[model samples]
Target chain A: MIEKIFVGSKKYWFWVFSLMALVGIGLCFYLEQFQYGLGITGMSRDVSWGLYIGQFTFFVGVAASAVMVVLPYYLHNHKAFGRITILGEFLAIASVVVCLLFILVDLGQPARFLNIILYPSPNSVMFWDMIALNGYLFLNLLIGWTNLSAEYKGLSHPAWLKPFIYISIPWAISIHTVTAFIYAGLPGRHFWLTAIMAARFLASAFSSGPALLVLLALIMRRFSKFDPGKEAIFGLSKIITYAMIANVFFLGLELFTCFYSGIPAHCHSFEYLYGGGRLTMIMWLSALLACLSLILLINPKTRNNTGWLTLSCCSVFASLWIEKGFGLVVGGFIPNPLGKITEYWPSLPEVFIALGVWAIGLLILTGLYKIAAEVKSQESNAA
Target chain B: MNRRDFLKIAGVGMVSTIFEPVLPYEIKPSKKRLALLIDITKPFDIKACLDACNKAHNIPEIEDPKHKIKWIWPERFSDVFSEQIDMPKEITIPVLCNHCENPPCVRVCPTKATFKRKDGIVMMDYHRCIGCRFCMAACPYGARSFNWIDPKPFIKGSNPKFPTRTKGVVEKCNFCAERLDKRESPACVEPSNGSLIFGYLSEMKDLISNRYCLRRKPDLGTSPSVYYLI
Candidate 1:
């Protein structure tokens, strides 16, 4: 089993080494954070949640977006996803792992996390979120491993696996939907307190998630044996376009409602994001980049260019992060009940800790993909 | 549905239906009642509330270094402003645990830690609260306060008698549950004497109507135990 993972030209050793180094740095940074307290991070009374929670919110969506591929490839029989669907399931597992870790880091007492379960609030969306994340993690792991193992033996999967894949499709959507509920359920938080929130989350998740997967597919082709065909890429690209269009459309509706209704509660958060206030620059930059990403993806020409495609994928991801992580979470607190804008910035230790967690997630993704690549290579060689 | 059936179907619970806040809590003209009176027109004296609370509910008095918010009001509109006036010709709405017949907090509490009293006051078992803040988020009145830090000693050495809450959990006013049990009035109203009224909410609602004139978020249907002398 160990030899299978090390099937050596020793190329992967470099990735493993680099990951190890990052792990060491991450540990040092996290230790400093623990010594001080969350105060080590930029978060304060106003921005109680910083990059860790923000990134957690963003990545959970990415994890959920795997449903796009999972649903269509397996249940709907979209032939375009035939060769690459397992990639999406594995990606879901990796992304959920990251999402869970980010939440762990954000907690004031990571150890007390089980208390959430012990003292679970079923009515609270958080309880449901925990349920979804754990459920999705188990479901995807089982499905990905079972299906891939079947692929290795070159045999059909048993009938039972089919239903699990179908269940995962909706479960993926639920994970992010429940995440959006974490925000939407807040009463006075203007930006998050929208009925449109869940729809907007799905829109963004569907778009950015598949876009990231597209880039991953591109990387695999460039670096290894798993070359997902253009038809598959194009199908995913179309799905991405549809979701992006919806995401942008939902954002537009938010703009119109906040402006037209002219309610301060609704408009203030928008203003905070778009330049009516301190976060204007970030809001503008995020909006511009995100908008441009969609525009680029929309056009058949630029969307097809690998370089441009990668750039746009990053732009969309960053834009969504700015919207959810920064504006949505922090803006809600400004003009706190006293309506004061107490600013927030994550400390260096916080940043490092966050980076460490991201590095760990990436390492997990890298390891899993390496094993998959090897297995695929062996299968093809046998054939 | 029967209690047994509801719990079984819900597949989860806080079994104590001890005091379900529905509405029209027992109209006994004689039973002692509890509530808080707020002049919502001005910045609420969260500090005053903390200062007044000697050892509210047996929970240790946490001296908020930042005085981290015990209460606040957005002060929405003209009617709200008018409603808060001293109203020698005006109002003073008592608050603290609406102990509503339909208390939103009790409905939403994940852990059955918060429940309505036989007296119809919403109460929390501090011991059971894990501080998830979901109850805080669910509460519409902004009545909840998270234990963002250790409970500060009210005095330099007062036996540190209040509950010391760890960070990450939430807390709020409990109508001085400890005081009520000891056969005393809530500390806030002790100063009000007759200026603040406590009794069966039904009778008190009538008193506010006949005497000072009463009103609340009538539309919300919370059936708040609190009533204002408008």
Candidate 2:
């Protein structure tokens, strides 16, 4: 079954080699970062976290999106999702790997990384995040591999996996929640010091995570014999629509609270993000696209059209990426602790490092998806 | 199951309970705990104190201020207190670690590397720090600094008494815990001519009782041990 990945078309080989090239390039820069210290990056004392942590946050969301498919299929017994459930699990495994790698590169002392586990401060949100992320990664690997092996042998999934499958649902929510707590519990950063932060994180995860999955499904249908099925895709779109609306609403609530109360610390970060130069344009553009996507997705006529569905999902993914990935971490640092503002822009090496991590994730996704697609194709041909 | 073994087990349990380390911040200051009081109303040269601290701690003289490792540094009062608009003469207040009763840095540190000592000094164990910089973000006073580059090259005439910090570790003024152990005042305080008071806050309560002293960002409920007398 594993040999199917090795036996592929020239186009498939091209994609695999391209991702490998990116991973190789990224590894070189990461080795340089390891040698020279994090000083090579654009991060200063003022902006301690830069592109690496931001990417970590984004990928955590991608990992959590797997539950969107898993819950409906396993809990509610939605049969359409049975075809694509493995895809969601495999996507999760890849995203979690990316999340862990981003953290690895971002560390100032990568060698001492295990101290977080060695002397685990249970009180720290980061400790809990480590547990949640590692747990989720293992759960997905176990479930994904076990189920795929069963499929290969033409047998039912083991009965024991059911308990673990049920546990994965809340474990998904816990991972994103712990990630949000990393920012929310901080004292000085007013932008992140909100109770709604976790709620906002989960909402955005639901929308952006599932939206990416939807886009991947569309691409799969075009390129392979495997389809996630119309019912499954439409079901996912409905989930994404509600979650995006909730995410937007949560952001509005944050804005209203910060402005209405007019606390200087709380209001300043928003001013820096939305009331200032290029950042303002980025924020407004994300808002506009989010609204446009929601409208497109909500209308049955537009949503039924493959063109609109793809466009809408892409828009939602982009909008949230800008809002959460690009803006959120950077905004929290502006109007820094002492009311001094220092801007941050990622260096070229940092960008490559991030791109490299993304390529690695896509490589894993491609390998996993190829195996699953091959198995499905074999079943269809036999039938 | 034997009586001697049962007694030994009970004794070990009781002794362990008695000796288990408690967080210093949680325990009320029964013994005299040290604190620093800085009088900013009078003009004083800050350069001398900054230099003394740099030399004492083996802090690097990074040419770029952006990457400089600051233990104790001067900050404009106007910037520190953004909401206040009163015409109290322009001033520079020396800011360092607050060694808070409820330190957000100590709380957020996953390895317990940054912790408050029994005498109320917030200290860092560099060997244990993974350099996640959660402490930097957690600190409201902008007190902590990270070793972004190798500090050894820039350190001019390294102090033999104090070990230099390596790259990829968070560091700050440990209230001169090493100096305190030697019965010497902090390097910065040694030069402040009587403007800087270093003593147990409980013992110095009579001295600073009526003075108009305030800690930075006191509203955050961190209960800073360092105070500024304006």
Q: What is the DockQ of each candidate?
A: 0.20, 0.63
Off by over 4 Å in 1: A1-11, A20-50, B1-34, B39-49, B54-128, B151-155, B192-199, B211-230
TM-score of chain B of each: 0.63, 0.88
| RMSD in angstroms between candidate 2 and the native structure over all alpha carbons | 2.3
Q: What TM-score quantifies how close candidate 1 is to the native fold?
A: 0.82
Indicate the residue-level lDDT of B37 in model 1. Answer: 42
lDDT of 1: 0.67
Instruction: Report the error of model 2 at residue A296, Å.
Output: 1.5
lDDT of 2 by residue, B56-137 (tens): 9999989876577989888888887666545467777788888887789988898888887778888899999999998888
Candidate 2 lDDT by residue in tens digits, A79-124: 9899889989999999999999999888888899999877877768
What does the i-RMS of model 2 come to?
2.2
User: Where in model 2 is the C-alpha error above 4 Å?
Assistant: B1-31
How would you encode candidate 1's per-residue C-alpha lDDT over B68-161 as one tens digit per residue? 4352222333333332333343433433444555665665554556766667677766666644445554554546665444445333334344
* Per-model CA lDDT versus the true structure: 0.67, 0.88
Displacement of the residue A99 alpha carbon in candidate 2, Å: 0.7
